[model samples]
Target: MKKKLGMFAGLVLFVVLMAACAADSSQEESDSGDSNSSGSEDSSAENQDTTEISFIHWRGEDEEVFDDIIGQFEEENPGISVQMNTYPSEQYQSNAQQMLRDGSTGDVFTSFPGTQFETINNAGFFTDLSDEEFVNNFAETSLEVGQSEGSQLAVPYQMVFNMPVYNKGMFEELGIEVPTSWSEYQAMAETLKENDITPIAFPGADIGPNQMMNSMMMNNAKNEDIFAQLESGEETLTNDWWINTLEDFQHFNENGYLQEDALGTNQDSAMQMVADEEAAMLATGSYHMASLKELNSDLELGFLPPITVSEEEVEYEGIHTATFMLAVNKNSEKKEEAKAFIEFLSQPDIASQYANETGQHLTVNDVDYESESLQNTSHWIDEKDTRFQPRYLIKEAAVEDAVLGSIENVLGGTSPEEAADEAQQVVEENID
Candidate 1:
């Protein structure tokens, strides 16, 4: 399984971040209101000297593209220049949090859409972009995910669609059409298992399980106002969507439909099973397609909405989870300069360039995905039938952590009901 950035890549990000750390004293001066003394507030509107601002982000692979974008921004706005710095994923959040808390985070930084972004926004760490012209470029739903309590605290850079990516060739060979209903899906799994083929590659890890939970919630619990009920203390994970989804997952586990020792399998291993023709399907988000293709260039992939637990109420839908919420640090003295960068990137052509290069969908209007694998899922999103991951409604990490643990337990021989009840207890104890 792949883990960690390569040594050379880690060193590059480390050195860049180290240079950014040199601006620490400037943050103290900015926080003290000393930097504002040089120019009257209105002078910026008239004419201002060229200013340099810092930008910090987490994706190492995006450094070159970001630097190119910065270059374009500088060319467009001769008065502002953006300096870019990046870090590996593990160190990114911790360092970004500490820097922001200390009022030393650079002028611009990237945030996530879930609990991490929620915590930072509530801390007043980001400027509100709700009324900015650049914000108007965002898709309505993307803006909704990037906002907190109706305030657009950040701008989304790219979008994600999480669905099952199956081997199209394998399905064709098995004479299996893409299953639209739950029972049909089960039948397909049974046929694969009887033929001594692993029906699906479920990495016994938590992410695929989490994706399953989101799918079930979107399908079966849509009418229940599940999040509202959880918020009001009128419901818990032990009921309805939570229990049924857990049991459905357990059923797949006990029936040998999922590859053995799924709990011990890592995501890359699960994907490898599909690549090597040992399994016919894998549940994942579109973001992994680039990496999967790198592993098996000949792989013919197709996205499928997972079969829901209930066929009576809702039909299957693809899932969309937005990523890379770009925010101007509230404490940065160069916020105006940061906003210039945001505005520059918001241009449809510029945003599409970034999206096309990165294999992600642009959050702004009219920018299409360049990845063929991602394009396979675009029809659902284009038709507005896709759902956001359930985590968007959840603000606590405990919800996911508990649910993933229950999945592991279910695979380890625990009764689905008992395990699900325990999962509910986790949410009950952790709800804010």
Candidate 2:
């Protein structure tokens, strides 16, 4: 009886031990599963904390600089990420409004001054930035370009001289001085032709002629706001100023001062001509200086304003345009993040870095420039009397087309008077 009782006790003890071991194993498995679930939850929370915003613009050439800027921004704001979207200038101009309307793109976007700004602002796509603290960092003159109907809708990031870029080394070698009058400019062109160099590589195929017209009319127009006056009932395209500007285009064509097949030449080809020393000047803007230098690392370039008046009558020497206006999408969910990015850009150190790296003249004040071209041309912004680009003042597309088309017509052998008359008729038809 005693042996049987001991055996039962041993069996019970063994069973209890087995149960204990099984419970230990189960607990270990549960802990492992819990660890994995906790890790996954943490990762998901991290992702949810980050806010990604898209910045859309047409300056594809600025991708590298902006990438660097965005990296800095991300590091500073761990919760925010910026994705840059770039389109070609023409494509952006045509499709940006749609992209903004879709609400899936362009938390922040850039637009060209005047027409693009007007169209986009009219659609109420821009967030009102009037009260942003960063807006005060920019000069009032620069801010005016982005204002509409008492609201500051955007901010202009670039300040560029809308004049021709000339080879300073060539001018120095030929013992030529910068022309101060229309007659002197013609003589300078003649000298360039005499030296077997194309005087001006005019890119009539694209926006080149339109940009050049700003400087071409700087001194010829009766006032700086001639296009605005024409837009109102105060002026007409058939005025002497318009006729004289068309005649200037004709003179360039008739005197062989422009490149061969100038009207067919595109902006890139024109830039190449100047960079390769085949032409002495390109009828483009200061914005192309970096590109020209990239083509020829040793090219010394300068701005050449087409002085269309006598020295005494020259009220303005060149044209300055505040363009590439940046604005936030009114409907964006990431409005605060987008504005923070712009405010980061408005900081003087960041703006200077962008200006020096891209060779662009920024509108941000107190920015120290290190670009060679920018340093050389800084006087144009500081000392020279420059008017805002008149080409941008025309709000009507048909009128702008007609006015620019008049230059093309003159280049194609139409008389200046006839071109002026045709442009005037188009203007009358388009306006009230």
Candidate 3:
């Protein structure tokens, strides 16, 4: 009986040992399966190919912001990546033209509206965004730039209008009010001169000022559709609107309304005049407000369009053009990725992000920036009922010969009519 009991105990011990061995084997298999699963996941991740697209623009100072935007986009879409390229603004136009000619440009690039931009857009180098859903995101009238024959060529990131900037402090202290007519503006200039103040520091020495000045004068024209006529060679600078404009330039030069050695004064000196309170107003680029504020934080600057051709003008109508825009390469192999980047740029937050950094305004409707200066400029633009046309309505080369040279000729003692005739001949020769 004792032997049988010992044998039974031995059998029970053997059964418990077998059960422990089976549990250990099952645990080892589970661990091996998990290791294989993890390896497979890592291998899959390594094998995935991300689509890469290139975005080239001319804003060197804004490169950091673009990088941040691109980073965020890549994180959201791990399957896509972007490469950013910055080019100098001065050389961008020619470089872009060369790139188009070579078919070696990046997937996306920046473009403006003008004879050159039109020539490029008409050449089918840029994809049409007219029917894109993102097209509705642009501000009113801002989307018209870079458009040809109802097809939108690029997305206007901002609406740039080059007009005069007045010193709000000077206006308040001297009891000067904003002008609503050509005569009123003239009177204000005369008053400032009488008070021993340089009325306006005109940057006549710079090449761009003339084109902008032409746009300002054209804003008050009796015929605003003059661009179409000018382009078609059906109109000349000797027309009534242009005649009045040339006469106005002569009047400014003769009456000491413009600074002394005005042709010698560059943009920096012109802006400096306003900053030092030696001048009450300045005619410069659209983005000067940020720099002026940086120079004098206490300075209250306000933007003003040209007073109308006459006293009948009620609204401050001017040309609105895209100074910088995003154009997708139509020949891009990664067209889908390029389009995705542009669509991303269409968001209000993205459009206004640069404004926050530099106080430059964006063209997206209802988009706002945190910059106080930008807000103030926007307020004035809205209150004055500003209207817009393509900022690049005329050719830059033609403007240099006809308009800038016309102003210089008038300053050099040529009669306004003769200057106008000379300008008309130049326009007839160079008009696009």
Candidate 4:
């Protein structure tokens, strides 16, 4: 009887011990699973914390410089990433509105000074950046270009002289001086032609003629705000000032001062002609200086506005435009991130880096320019009598197009008078 009772006790103890061991093993397995699950959750949370923003602009040429800046921005901001989107200037000018309307492509975007800015602002596509701290970093003149009414809508990033870029070495070699009067300019062109050099590589295909018109009519117009006058119906495209500008184009064409097939020549080809020393000047802006230098690093360059008026009548020496206005999309999901990226760019050191790398004249104050091209032309920013580009002051695209198209029409064999009349009709149709 004792032996049977002892055997039952032993069996019960064995069963209890087995249950305890099983529970310990189960708890060990559960802890291991929990540890892996917690690690995965942490990794997923880290991924969710990162924000990506899109920066859209028309400066395909500045892609490399911008990429470098973006890389620095990402390093400084570990939680954010930037995706850059660039388009050709013409395509961006035409399609930027449609792309921005959806709010998917451009978390941050750029617009031109007058009509495009007004159109985009009126549509409420821009965030009011009036209160942003970064807004204080830019000059008031630069800021004004981006403002609509009282609200600070955008920030102009580049201050560029929209005048012709000439080959300094070529001019020196030919014993020619910068002209201060229309007659002198004509003589200079004749000399260049005499030397078997194209005087002006005019790219009439896209924005070339429109850009050149800024310098061509700077002093010829009686009023500085002639384009504004046209918009207000106080003047017409058929005004003498407008006709004279077209006639200048005709004179250049007739004199063989422009490149062969000028109307068909694009900006790139025009730039190359000057770079290769085949042409003495490119009827474009200082914004293209870096590009021209890229084609020929040894090329010495300078700005030369067409001096259309007598030296005594010259009111402005060159044209300056505050363009590529940067704005945050009003509907962006990552507004904070987008604004942060802009703020990063607005910093003086960063802006300097960008300016030097891209050879752009930045709107940011006190940025040190290291590029030879920028240093050579930096004096024009303050020392010269530069006027805001009248071409940008036109607020209606149709009217602006008609005005610019008149120059193209004259280049394509139409008389200046006929082109002026045609442009006036289009302007009246659009405005009236």
Error of 1 at 418 (Å): 1.2
Each candidate structure's TM-score, on Cα atoms with residue i matched to residue i, is: 0.83, 0.88, 0.81, 0.87
TM-score between model 4 and native: 0.87
lDDT of 1 by residue, 369-410 (tens): 676766765665567577777766666667767767787788
Q: Give the per-residue lDDT of model 4 (tens digit) for 1-432.
A: 999999999999999999999988866643322222234667646646566677999998789989999999999998887889999987888889888886766888999888888888888999999999999888776688888778999999999888899999998989999998989999999999999999999988765587898998888785777878787789987878888888888998998989989999999889889988999999989888999999999998899988877888988899999888889999777789899999999999999998998888989888999988899998887799898899888888899889888988999999999999999999888885
lDDT of 4 at 242: 83
How do these models rank on TM-score, best leading? 2, 4, 1, 3
Q: Which stretches of model 4 miss by more than 4 angstroms?
A: 1-45
- Which lDDT value does model 1 have at 58? 81
Worst 10 residues of 4 by lDDT: 29-38
Spell out the clash pairs found in candidate 2.
none
Error of 2 at 424 (Å): 2.0
Residue-level error in angstroms, candidate 2, position 152: 1.5
lDDT of 3 by residue, 1-432 (tens): 999999999999999999999988866643322222234668545534666666777888778888888998888777677877888876776677667553335687888667557767767788887777777887656676667787888877866656677788888899988877788888888889988999878877774345446445755464656766776788777877677776777777788988888887888888889888899877764578878887778888777666645666544454445557777788766777777887787787877776677668777766766777777777634554455543356555565456667768887779878988887787777654
Task: Give all candidates' CA lDDT scores.
Answer: 0.74, 0.87, 0.71, 0.87
Backbone clashes (count) for model 2: 0
- Minimum summed lDDT over a 10-residue window in model 3 is located at 30-39
Question: RMSDs, each prediction?
Answer: 10.5, 13.7, 17.4, 13.5
Query: Residue 36 of candidate 3: its Cα lDDT?
Result: 28
